[model samples]
Target chain A: MELNIYHLYPEHLNLYGDLGNVNCLKRRCLERGIEVNVVNFTDDEKPDLNDGDIFFIGGGSDRAQQLVYKDFLQYKDVLKELIEEGRAVLAVCGGYQLLGTSFIDKQGNNIPGLSILDYESKYTGDKRIIGNIIIETTLNLEPNKLVGFENHGARTYSKYQPLGNVLVGRGNNDDDMKEGIVYKNYIGTYLHGPVLPKNPHLADHLILQALRNKYGDVESLEPLDDEIENKAYEKFIKLYGK
Target chain B: MVNVRSMIALYAGKFSKQVLKLINSSGTALPGKLALRIDNNFLDNIEEKCDTVIMVTGTNGKTTTNNLLNHVIGTRTDKILSNLKGANMIQGIATTYVNNTKDHYDYGIFEVDEGTLRSVTRYVKPDYILVSNFFRDQLDRFGEIDNLVEDVYTTIEKLPESTLILNVDDPLVNKFTQLPNKIIKFGLDLDLDEVQNSSLSMKNCPLCEGKLQYSSHVYGHFGNYECDKCGFKRPNPDFVVSNLEEKASSQMITIDYGDEELVFEYPYTGIYNAYNVLGVFTVCKQLGLSDDEIVSAMGDFSFHLGRMEEMEYKGKIIKVILTKNPIGLTQVINMISNDERSKTVVHILNDNPADGEDISWIWDAYTICEREETVLHYYCSGIRAEDIALKKKYDNVPLDKIKINDNFKEIIDTAIEDDVEIVYVLPTYTAVFETRDYIENVVKSN
Candidate 1:
């Protein structure tokens, strides 16, 4: 089966190598002998979202994120449909903010979000929490906690229940609030790029779920050598594992 | 006749070294805090006395360039005073001055931070400045490449008759050479080893806003190039490295200075280092160093720590390259990516806010890494381990081959045991110091 991944606003919002998210998804699927096609949508080019199986959006600056807001309005309906269809979606940092209801920028101008996720993000009086982040959730089929890095100045608030609980690092809100939104097959968070390299199990869980949803069974997915992955897990457990 | 408080103030300046030693041993959360505080008062007093000072700043090669100039000038005469410890900021510069005899050291051969260069230069009042290159670095803190370039130029405008030494390879830096002053430009000539095409950055010439026509790129923005619209091109350097090639283990850099030609061998790898060495050659030649002295001094030079510093850990030789930005990381990645041997990479991303609040810069680097199959294991550590792991996963690294470790000890241990000839450690600014401390205190001890 072929996996189609759409990377939104690759040029403008990719301030911190957010494109690594697209690279991670592409590499993992290709290794499973799954044909993967990546479509990068930037300033003017509109991508055919119907062809994509998984969708990704990464972080950038406030101005770049504003630019994405303009482009996002054009594809909002398509993105909503994709998420509703149980397609795997991962939005990180600025991408996560863009997927929300609205983002209140530094000047206090609220730029409308795509509203794919239930959360609303705003530039907090204090720069949003930054540093290593740990999230504990049942989203991952495995019992282990989901740990990743968090670097965002925008604070997200939701009147409804948050996506998940913060296990260790800074989450979605300023004060240990919900980290990210997870509903159906969609997963969006403030975690920046390089999230999967440190959390292999999380990557596997996301991939397995995507595979199972698409192929009805994950047996065809062959696991590579686990030495490095296991060592990384053990290190995380030793450092932030409680 | 001095009062107790006055004596205490004088003693504070005298004990700056001891203070730094204490801070280093105390394991304080902010070790540089005390040095910064003490240096502030000391600098306030020195600013009133000194007339002219200058700063040299950049990412990868500032240390070597600053050190080379200091060494060459010091040999001819003890007229220069510099911060040799690679402390390129207000605190480090202040510390260097406080420790030295008051009202001494004619020239301040200090390397300033790219972001802090303008601020520091204002107080230091550098008569001469050398700017290497501007690359995408520390997204959260630095904002963007254009921001840094503007900041440096603003600082340059404030200087009076300052001799600006610039690297023409970077279009951003090349623009500074146009400033009405004694501008000295140095860059690598397009050779066979240089990459033919430019990467994501360096798409346009910063001068003419026109498309840049590149002969070749030594690394990221460092290369020989000419602007199509404007006649701005990489100028021939007074000191040029010709017929540059990597010998078995060392770099064979043949220096061609106007009338004289000298061949020197560097223990460091890559053509980028050849440019760094050439930067030193230009500074030394301008500072009146004999050909023999210049060549001899370079042979003895070695990176102090956390910069291409090679050491054996657990019987495995590991080369540590401090990659604080995209360009620096790309250079190191390009260096090892072409090799056939299986490699293990440890990428540490810190969320110190100072390191940059954004960690998305990893994507630009993953695109340039050549051999994915030969990567035996990729270890992503630090506060942002999961983010890095996710990025690698996005990059198509086999999920099983990649690992995320938050603890430094575990990451270093796992990386050392991985069966690979070359281990590349790319850490941000704060992580560089933290990793260096771990290697010195923990890994090196074992």
Candidate 2:
């Protein structure tokens, strides 16, 4: 079995280890005897969204996000199709905000987004949501309290199902008692603990969904021992909270 | 009186320093903060009097470069004021000034934080402003790197008299051209060895949003690069490393300073430290230090600002290299991978305030995989041991070769007990101190 992973706008959005999610996903797949091919879609090149079994994007700085904003639009229609077909998409902070309809900046400017989901982010221009974040995710990734770090300035609001409830740090808009937007096979959030290695379940979920997209129906991926991942999560929750 | 507030602040700061010292605290930033509160002109008053005030600002190597300059210059004259312990904000700079106000120093060397450059320059006028290289660092505290470069541009815009020393090899630093003031640029020559990849590429040009192409790619997004859309390119460095040869525990480098060449055996390894030495050398040369003086000073300098340290624990040689960011971590990983010695590499990570709360950079760094032929074992310790454990495990490190132990003592011991020739412990800022203390305690007990 093989998986094709497309990294979107890595040149621009490679801020804060967002590529780790792809590495983790690829590693898990390889461990289970699954071959993996990673194709990075950077500046100027057109991404073959059809070849994508699992699509990943990390967060970028503001200028960097704007740099790739136009290029990102090319993925909207194809990404929606892929999501509908049960393909997995894991978008982080700025990547998470990009999937929304629009973002309101400090001057109340409504910057347009990809509109892959019905959500919007607003810059508070106050204290940034920066800290260790633990969320009770309903994705049923066992030890369901997902651990990661949040260092974003904007708060996102989505009417669709949330990825998780905020057990500790601020998630989404900080007041929603929620974190991230979850729809179909797409999971977008402000979790930058690269939101994969420590939270092994999410990494596997993306892999499993990618496998399903390839084979139509799949039972599950062969489980590898997640002792390190779980222990890291446990240590995070113990040192921090929730 | 205009001078009354300054005088009171000076006396009060001195009294507070004494009180803190008596109370058994070296109080690096607090005394400065109090002085700034009492008189905002505290740093200005000191800067106005100093003949040569050098501001060293950058994401990394600020402490190392500042200390290197201080060490070389101090050999000539004891009339020097410096923040040697790395208190580098406006408050920290203020503290240094308040403490050293009584002395009519010839040189006031300071390690100014990159983010606080504008804040520091607004009050004080530096004779020479040295900028090393900029990287994405402490994002939770400083926001982002683009903003930092912009802030630096604005900071340098108004300072007409301050001579700007820059690292032109870094494409980001190339944006500072067209400035009115004198600029001295330094970088590694294209002839030296280059790294395979950047910490991660900025892809687009820092000047224009155009595509950036590198003729020679060094570690991180540093090297001889040019922009396609705009005609922006890496400036020819005034002081370039013409030759760089790695010795056993040091680097033999020959720096070309346009008119003369300064050849010296740098007591440190890595191109990162080479850049630091080059920056220091540029500043020293601009200060009229002869090539021989610089060579002598650099050859004799020993600065262990907790960057990289070496010790023997339980008869096993152990080396600790501070691993904070992706580029720094990648450098260490590459160093260990190239090492022929049988070694146990330990990664100690912490999520404290000192260490960026976001531990995502760990994933962004190079992985130690498929090179386990030399390294015997891997131990993950510190508060975030499990995080790095996940990193190694996914890096294709066999489970038996990887050990996850949060206890620093036990992990360090386990690593030392491995039949390897060396034990390499790479720790974050907070972890480095704790790990060092543990090692020192072991030596003391023996």
Candidate 3:
């Protein structure tokens, strides 16, 4: 099987080891006898939605987000169509913010988002809610935990349902127990320890979703021995999770 | 005239230093903290005493560059005060000044943290502000690189008289030249391929937000860059490394400063260190130091702990490389990959406030996964050892090759069990100190 992943605004919006998400998706797919091709669309380059199976967007600095925001408007319609078609997408941190209706900057100016998802984020304070985060998630009728790091100043409010409930750390906002959003096949989260490598299950889940989108019935993946991965995940949960 | 509160602060700081030493504490920041608490105007008073103050800051190489400045400038005169003790924040810088204000030093060379540059420079008007380079570092604590640049820019705006020595190769650092100040730019003129690796942070122009066209990447974001959109380009360096040839353990370079070109052999291993040499050379030339004097001072300088310093443990050679960010870690990995010896790699990752609790950067240092053939085994140890281990695992190092443990001794023991001749220990800020101490007392105990 072949999966084409579009990495949006990689040059500007790629911050905090965000490219690792692309690496995780590629390596995991390659390991499972799937050819994964990653195409980087930066600045004003529009992504071909038909060619894309999984769309990954990572976090960035505030300035980077502004730069990406300008170019984001040009491709919002295509992105909306991709979301409506139930194309598998994972947007993290700044990418998560950009998937929403609007994001307010430090100066309280609202930067328009794709609005494909019912969410809005605002830079409420100078303080950022940062630390190790553990979220209890139920995607595909399987209850599991996702562990990663959150480093963002904006507090997001979602009208649509979130990806998970907060298990250990601050989620979308300090007031809410909910974490990321799961609109159709789209997933948006503040988890950016690149969010995928540490949570192989999630990486596999996204891959499974992409495969299912393409071929309809997707069976369980040939389980690679996740002894070390489990060890790392278990350790993080034990250390940082409640 | 010095106020009574300033006098109290001075005496209290002096007394605290004495008491701290009696308790065997390094007291890098305690005295300064106490002194500042006594009188908020303590640093301002100390600044009045020092004739010339130089502030050095950036994401990496602050310590090395500051020490180089201290060596080059201090050897020329005895009346010099420097924070050679690795206390870089406001408290630590204040401690250096509070303790030495009475001595009335002619020069003060203090390394300021990028986040603390604005706060520190508010009082001490430096004669020279030397920025080494900037990268995505300590993201949790320092927030973002743009925020750090804003802080340093604000500080520079207040001090237009201060001579700004910047690394022009860094687009972020080069942007500071836009400010009206007496600026001297220092950069590596060698081929970008010679020094640059796969890891890069700033790929877009800060001004135009356009994709940066790199003629060469010296290391990190330091390179000859041009943005066709905004026409923002790399400035011609005032003091430049016209040529660089890497030897076994040193670098031979011809430094061009306008009409005067001096070819010298620099005793540094990494290409990043070559940039450090160029920065120091620029500072020395700006200070009116003779070429012979500057070369002699730099040549006599040696490694200052935990930065590519090697140690012997039993029959194995353990090279301790301090890696805090992706840029620094990538350089160390590149240097180690050049070695053909069968070696065990130990990576210590701590999420302590000092090491920037956000462990996402480990993934960006993808080069760690590049030289898999040379590495025999990977011993991942620290508070966040599992994170590093997971990163390595995903990078395709087989699960069997990685041993995740918090204990340094056991990790080292396992690495040497297979008669590994070399063990490369790459550690973060706090982990490096702990590893150094562990090697001193346990691993290499006579």
Candidate 4:
């Protein structure tokens, strides 16, 4: 089956390797005999979301996030409808902030978010999180742990319960708070570009879920070589594993 | 009797060496106590005492150009102070002055940071300024290339008609040659190899809003070009590098000034180093160095500590190339990625704030084509190890062909395990030092 992926704010939210998210998904799906159609939407250009199966928004600077906020406001209603309709969606970093209620920049400027994820982001004085980060998560639907990369300055606080618990790295807030929002068919986090590349299992989890939801109880494909996967796993365990 | 401050300041040379060693050992940030104890504002007190001061500033090639100028002057009896330890900021400059001053130096050959160039130049009062080029770097701190250019120009405006040595090859630096100063320009003659592969000349012309057309690009935005509407052209350089030839082993660069031509057999491999050699030759000839001394010194020079520094690690030859930007990484990839023979590569990426918290730049670097079949085994390390491995995998490098080692020690061991002919390491700035420390310890233990 053909899949359409909408990448929002390619220019602004591309501060980190966020483009790698689109590339990773496209590559993985193509390898599994799937045809993925990717469309990059930026500035005032509207994307044709009628056939979109998944939507992605990556991260950028505060200035860039504000610019994207101005551009994304035009399609706020459409984006909300898509999320409500169970179209798979992922928002990371500035994109995650824009998916929330509001974001306060370092200079105290407030920008409105889409409020898709019931969370708010506030700029904290602490800027650096220099090392590796590991997320301890068990999706109710999936058996494997969710692993990805995290690099951000904005601390997101939610009055409501977080998407999940933080196992390794600093999450949404300074304290033990949910790092991102994961609701029915929607995933939003501060993890910046190439989140899927570093965590192939996470990418597989998302794609497999989307596929299973559409195709129903599809048999699993043979995993990649164990030797290589084990080496990668050992590396992750040493840095962020318990 | 000398005061306590003077006593400590006099021995600042010894203290600076010890501090560098401490930084190497601990892998810690710049020590606060050392910075506090050393009087970095010593330049303010002696600005009126010096007759001439020259500040060379740019992202890359500043150190080489500064060292060349220092070597060419050959006024050994004269006192000279410079950022010899790769310290290019205000504190670094202050530390250099504090360490080198027994008396007023005849010339202060310093390399200043691009963002701090304006303030540092104002305080240092440079008689001569050598600006190499302006490229996109450290977006969080520098914002854009134009901001850095403005900073350098503003600082140059304040200087007293002293000489401005610039690279005409770079459009940004070439713009300064038009300014009111005793300006000298240096550039490379566009050859077939230089012009054929110009991918990075897409930026708008600084002179006109019109698109830029290049006869050829050396690398990044450095190339020979002419504006379509404004009639601004790449001028005949005061110093030109010609006869560029690269063999399997080493590269040769020939620099031609008005009356003399010096052929330098460069120890390093890439055209970028040739530009650096050209910058050095321009400064040397301008400062009155004989062709013989220039040629002699060129052969004797060694790559600085973290640059393309080579070392024997685990009975294998390893070449460590420091990559901070796309252009730099592209050069590293170009130099090694073409060889069909199987080779091992250790790619490291860090998330340290100093490393620009955004690790997304790695995607741009990894997109450069690698000879996948010849790349026997790839190792990715650093805080962003998995991210790098994922990038390589996305680039169609087989999943089984690459290894991700989070622990740097494990990565090094894996890289050095086989009897590899050449191991290519590309690392970010933080990773470069960390990798260097790791290699040093491994070598010492063996």
User: Which candidate comes out best when scored by DockQ?
Assistant: 2
Model 4 steric clash pairs: A16-B360, A17-A193, A17-B360, A18-A193, B195-B216
Chain B of candidate 2 achieves a TM-score of 0.93
Worst 10 contiguous positions by lDDT, candidate 4 chain A: A221-230
Cα lDDT tens digits, model 3, B111-201, are 8999888888778889998998888888888777787887788879999999999999889899999999999999888765744433374
**Whole-model Cα lDDT per candidate?**
0.67, 0.81, 0.82, 0.68
Evaluated at residue A220, the lDDT of candidate 4 is: 69
Judge candidate 2 at residue B210 and give its lDDT.
Answer: 85
Kindly report the root-mean-square deviation of model 4 from the true structure over all alpha carbons.
5.8
> For candidate 2, lDDT tens digit of each residue in A20-86?
7888888888889999999888766776789888889778877677767777676688788778777
Q: Which 10 successive residues of model 2 chain B have the least lDDT summed?
A: B190-199
Worst 10 residues of 3 chain B by lDDT: B192-201
Kindly list the per-residue Cα lDDT of model 2 for residues B57-176, writing each as its tens digit: 877888888888999998899888889878898888877877774447898898888878888888888999988878777788777787788888888998999999998888777677
What value does the lDDT take at residue A135 in candidate 1?
70
lDDT of 4 by residue, B135-225 (tens): 5555545544555677787778777567888888888888887688898898888554432221233344566644456777677677788
Tally clashing residue pairs in candidate 4: 5
Which 10 consecutive residues of model 4 chain B have the lowest summed lDDT? Answer: B194-203
Q: Which candidate is the best by TM-score?
A: 3
